[model samples]
Target: LRKSELKGLEIPGKLERLIATFFADDTTVYLSENDDFNDLQKILDDWCLASGAKFNIGKTEIIPIGSPEYRDLLRQTRFLNSVDGPKIPEHIRIAQEGDAIRSLGALIGNNICQVEPWTKVLERIDQSLDQWARSKPTMEGRRLIISMIVGGMTQYLTKVQGMPKEVEEKLTRRIKRFLWDEKTHVRINKETV
Candidate 1:
């Protein structure tokens, strides 16, 4: 509940002390090496016991964040990586670099500009286009369809996290090609719907 000064946690290149993120039943706790995991788990277990909810250790993971070199160091020292290192709970594994962890609906990994995050949305867009391809809707109908596709950026799946420029262009090209029923998607110019 209280934000304590995050000490001994050398995760981010630039840090923001300690913080806990809660989304409904799921909880993410950020801590440093100096923190006592046993005590923390006990508190969480107590909370879970009182709340009639079970702590799902199977879904728990240790996500290492920082510069690549710093993350490597954290990985090297992980209890899994080093038997002599501090022991972690069974079923909990440290995430490797470039691993995409699906939190809520977002695919998050080490790279911020990665296209992976938009893969699902792109799939949905493609499906919509495929379904609409057979229809002989008017030009205005195509424009509305394109508008819905664009609106996905603000939708819950994406949540306004801007995608890579390449992805934006890919979406534009595909939708435009579908609008004009053209074979070469890239050939659809901006002036043509």
Candidate 2:
């Protein structure tokens, strides 16, 4: 009927310090509008035990869960890079030949000039997308689509410019894989009611 903190436990003290880094043990009081005493008490007990912190049963109360008033707060919160799309620099937002070549090299786990042409191809794709976007707003989707289109064009340009055959072959294989992934997707259309 009364809350109690487990005392005389040194091991638990050390554990509490360690877990506190990852979990919170803050006091949050709630009062239930409905008679869900059984469920609420069980929840309090479970959380108290699991968290290695004593729940002040005397002070604990369950309230009806309601939505936060500031519903749009989440939209303005700053988030980590992982939460944001593609971990690339802002300057390279559009794929440039230099960026593409770097990405191609990155893909094949290579550096140096092995995939320079591929990088140039990526740069062209980026430039082309920018041009298309400026000319037609609806063509925004063409950004990714043009990458595949220009991959072939840039590869041809690279050949005319006389890139190494081995490098060419490697870039071709890498771009093919990239295009295959982008072009090949499952389309699920909804049946009308």
Which runs in model 1 stand beyond 4 Å of their true positions? 1-18, 79-86, 157-161, 183-193
The digit string of per-residue lDDT tens for model 1 on 1-193 reads 2343334344467555545767897777776555555656677787788999888878887776656775677576654223344556656777787787777667666755477778877888888877876787777887887787656543675453556787879887887687777755555466963
Candidate 2 residue-wise lDDT, 102-192, digit = tens:
2212321112254455565655655555555465433334435555565555655554445667755655554444433334553544362
Report the Cα lDDT for residue 96, model 2. Answer: 19
Which residue segments of model 2 deviate by more than 4 Å? 1-112, 137-152, 157-193
Given candidate 1, what's the lDDT at residue 76?
68
Clashing pairs in 1: none
Tell me the RMSD of model 1 versus the true structure: 4.4
Q: Which residue window of length 10 is worst by lDDT in model 2?
A: 73-82
Cα lDDT for residue 101, model 1? Answer: 79
